[model samples]
Every structure is written in C-alpha cells, then in structure tokens.
Target: MENKQKKIVLTGGGSAGHVTPNLALVPELLQHGIDVHYIGTDDGIEKTLVHDIPFHAISAGKMRRYASVKNITDIFKIFKGTKESKRILKGLKPDLVFAKGGFVSVPVVWAASKLKIPVILHESDYTPGLANRLCIKKAQKICLSFDTADARSERSILTGSPIRKDILDGDRAAGLASLSFSGDKPVLLIMGGSLGAQAINDAVDAALDTLTQRYDIVHLRGKGKLNPGLEGSDSYRQYEYMEDGLPDVFAAADIALSRSGANAIFEFLALKLPALLVPLPLSASRGDQILNAGYFEKRGYAHVLEQENLNALALVQALDALWEQKDEMVSVMGNSKEADGTSNVLNVIFENIGVQ
Candidate 1:
C-alpha cells in the first residue's frame, strides 16, 4: 500500500512581508507532490493575495505596538481565531505547519501545537515579531533571515529569508521590462511593503517633483491611497501591487526608497540595488525594520532614515548622497548576492519533511 501524500499547512498574512515568502514556497512544495494549504485572515491582503490557493480562513486579529482601546477587540479575536485554526487543522491533518510570522499566525501556531502537530516558523526579521516570538518555544524549528534570530529561539536556524525563484533567477533585462521601464534613464523604485507606509509615501510626495525631473520612478504605493501630487508627477508612476512582476522594478531601479522589511531587503540584495531605507517607526511595532536597516548601514550597503527626522529636503539630500556613491553602493550590495535564501530554506524544510 502506498502512503498518503503528506500535507503541509502554511499559516501567515497581515502583510506581504509575511505572505510573499510563503507564496514563493508554494510552487516548490507543489512540484514535490506535497499538498499545501494556507491559513490566514480575510481582513488582510491575504484575502486577495491567496485567492486561488487552498486557504483556511481564520481571524487572528491585530498586534499593536501601543495600547489601544482596540486591543480589547484583538483579545477576543485571538481566542476565536484559535478555535478556527484547530477546526481547520483537524480537517487537514497536515504533517507540518509553517507559520510565517504575524499576528495572524498566532492562532494557527497555537492550534497546531495543541494538536501535537509539529510547527515550523520562518522569522524574516533580525528581531522577531510577536507571533513568532510566541511560537519560538513551541516551534520544532525556526527559520530566520538573520543570525541574531537564533538568540530568540534555541531551535532557530539562520536560513535567511526565502525569496521567490523568479527573483533569485532574474536578470537586469528581465526586471526592466517586467517593471515597464525604458532603459533610457535611472529608475527609482519606491515601496513601503504591502500595506504601504504613510510616512514614506508622504516623504516621496514631498520630493516627487524634484525626484521625477531626474529619474523615472516606479512607486509601488501598496494599499495606501495616492497623494495627489504623486498622481500628477510626469515622471512618477504608481502601482497598487506588482502582481509577481517585481524584478523589472528592481532591475530598473538605480536606487530604491524602501521600507526595510526582510523580504524586500533580501530581494534588494539579490538585485544588488542600492536602497535608502526609512525604517518604519516603533509605533508600528516593527523594531525589526530598524535592526534590518542598521545591519546595512553598518555595512554601507544602504542608508537609513528614521521617520521622526524625515522631510522632503532631507530625503532629497539622502538620495543625492546615495546616488553619488552609486558605484560604491552597488559594489557593497553586490556582495549580498551570496544570499540565495529560498534554496537554503527549502532544503531545511525538505529535510524536516524527510524528503531527501
């Protein structure tokens, strides 16, 4: 008799930072004849992002950095989401659960553990998120993007972050066309991750006119509504989402104004694109971005700007400095190509699943 095909459940969402890597993992697992199921909340970008995939809907609620009256609502959501997760896991009976870090992952990880199903978590930050932190003790393995993550868990492995295969394999020409950029001028790619960063968007808005005059810009605005000024810039183009064709944007970019999310940071490294990072403020409960930014700043691979001190002029000045150092920055970033994270992570997962 043949054994049943093993099922692997991936729990994550709330932002592209968490879901993008898991999305990159899906095709690889599927090719091996393993079944993949996603567990995430409907409220986040996941609803639209994971549309065609087999996903179990559950509500994990929000994790806020500061105390909010809304925190009361989140408390109840955690309990409810946990119950939903247990029900879903019971039906799927997956051999393992991969919980990508976020508040939405909390319920699923909790449920998977309670059911005695082994769980693996991927932490994309140098500093772990609340959900991954909660699961660190319980997870059978923790795959991390940074070496520092090992401090958070005894079982953690520094696998870097999983990047999409296309991204890892993409070339300069592939990215340029995919991003709809002509090769005539320098391109500046702007992104604040999936949900967008109002602060970063605001700074971009402040500098748009000046920026567009010099460079053709690809602004991935995410879900944030556009600033009127950006909408009107002759040299600026906005995308609510990139839809799996990010390489062109990356390829077209001579410099990037970006948030320091682990996925983007690693992808930028893979592309060898110089970046000016504006770490999201602590108010967003993302100390991870700060650590990520610091790593590059310490290495001269990128520039860092804290949100509190940011303004249009300062942003312009920073861009000027990074642009002037383009060759040096690119050289520093070139070394980052050594990190092909997806393959490393997949190897670990395959090993865990006994698929050598």
Candidate 2:
C-alpha cells in the first residue's frame, strides 16, 4: 500500500467543544498515513482550532431554538453552505467524512450523503444535539459518548467522548508554576464553558475569600469575563482562555469546579480528576449538561449542583463535599470504561474509510 491510503474530511464547530474532538483524532490519522482536510465556517471557532490542516471555509447557519428573524435568513446561508460543502467534498473526494456535530457539521454531512461519501458522526452528549438530529438519517453510523441501554441504536457505536492527547500530558508542577501557585494547597480548576457562565463567575467571586484559604484557584473565566477587581489576589488567577497550557492546568488540579459540558467533563474524567459539576438549567440549554453531569454523578466520578440551587454558599459547600470524596471519586474515574473515547472513535473512522 502507498504511504497515504485514504483522505478524509473532518467537520464540526460552532464552539470549542465541537472542534476539540476532531482535533483529538488528527495525530492518529496522520500516523496512519491518511490525509486530513477540515471544512468549517469562515469565522467559526473551528477555523482557528484547525489552523495547521488544509482548511476549507464555508458559510454556516446557526439554527436557534427560539423564533428569530435571523433564523429565516439563515436558511439561505444553509443552502449556500451545503452547496459549498458539496463542491469541496467532490474536489477532495475524501474516502469518508468524520463529523463532530454542530450547526456547521449539518451541511457538511448532508453534502457528504448526497455525494455518496460515507459519514460518521460523533455525539458528545448523552442525547443527540439539534445538528446531529437533523443529520442522523444521512450518517452511516452514529457514535455515542453514553452507551446506556436507552441511547442504543443499530447504527450507534459506543465511543466515549474523544479526549485530546495533550490534555493527559499535563505536569502538575508545571501547571502550578504557570499559575504562580505555591503548590502547597489543592488547586481548584474552574471552567465556565466557552461562552462564560455568569452565574458561576459571580458565585466563585463571592466565595473567593473562603475558597482561597484551602485551594489555589485558576479560573478560565471565558472571553471578556475576567473581573479586574480580583486581579491582585495571590491565590487566584484568571485567564480568558488557555490552550497551550491547559494540560498543565488539568494536571495541577486536584478538584475541578465547572459547568458540566460533555467535552469538559469528559476531559476531567479522562484525567481521573474529581469534579463538582454545575449543569446549565433546562431554561438555558436543552439540559444536555444536566444529563451529562447526572451521568457522571451516577457513576461516582463527580458531584452535581443544579443551577437553580447554585449560589456562593452552595458553590463553596458543594466544592467542600467534593474535596472530601475526591480520592474515592478519582478511584472510580480511574476504572471508568468511558474515560476516553479517542481510540474507539478512531477505530470506527478507519473502518468506515476502509483505511485499516
């Protein structure tokens, strides 16, 4: 066989969550001698995340849950994106398409199906997202993070969420040093998703005086969410985002306090790091995070604090409880079958593409 046996296109992104899993699969694809191409929206986060690859930009239409004037206009954009995707896929003639679901991926998958290119979709959430729901019939196989009895379908493969290889290489000391932390106290990592969770930020800020005494805080406050007033606190550090050093932070953290997005929580689980999860309420999202957190909680990997009951006091208390059970939680996570889905997802990809 030649060094490169097949070519494939990876599509997904509207948020960091969608792109990271696809990125996780890149190294293995390259190692297997398969060519990789990426298709994403011109300005979506995927373009930035997939910079090193051969990237194709297409228009993406975000379908919102609620009624909006923009939703009507987005229809035209979706058609344009679909057309652009078809043209790109035809020219590339990739053997397969591996899509991590997002608004951007729906068009790409549809285009792939129309062109008779096999498509595999990886769903990170327990339940399918809107984009995945739309493209399910078009996909040749659906990969699931949650492999429960109810989530099973004939076309579904039980692949846990793919975790980036870099995320597991974090050095605890390097992580502490990066944050200027003394390494004396437990490091608590807080992530509020990519868009920032105002409620989590406000609660953490309110509980800082108490929280800092026992833990060194490194807060990923999301874009433009940093509080200037908390700048000088010795035990606290805030960054808009961390990409290069995120693994180190993950390594340094003994316990994490975060919103239960599937990708973030799975990252924590993969590292065997115990977490206290605060899920987005139903009103905010489709309650996917709530289900993601509940799954972890049921498995003893994390603790869940619903948004409705979240506040400064509850945040501090829940974290304390998590700390008390950290060792047990870590033990459970160490043995969890769903810790990382990278390998399983790769197996399905290569199988579909007939590369291996």
Best by lDDT: 2
Root-mean-square deviation per candidate: 3.2, 1.8
Tens digits of lDDT, candidate 1, 137-247: 778998877766363566777777887877755466776666556667788888988788888888888787888777888888877566555465546788876866666
Question: What C-alpha lDDT values do all the predictions have?
Answer: 0.81, 0.90
Model 1 poorest ten-residue lDDT run: 225-234
Superposed model 2: Cα runs more than 4 Å off: 1-4
Q: Roughly what TM-score does model 2 have, to 2 decimal places?
A: 0.94
Model 2 per-residue lDDT tens digits across residues 1-356: 64546998999999889999999999999999888999998899887788667999999898888899999999888889999999999999999999998999988998999999999988999888999999999988988998677357788878899988989998998988989999999999999888778989999999999999989999999899989999998999998888678899999999998999999888998999999999999987898998889999999999999888988899989999999999999898898778768988999887887676
Name the best candidate (by TM-score): 2
TM-score of each: 0.85, 0.94
Backbone Cα, N, C clashes tallied per candidate: 2, 0
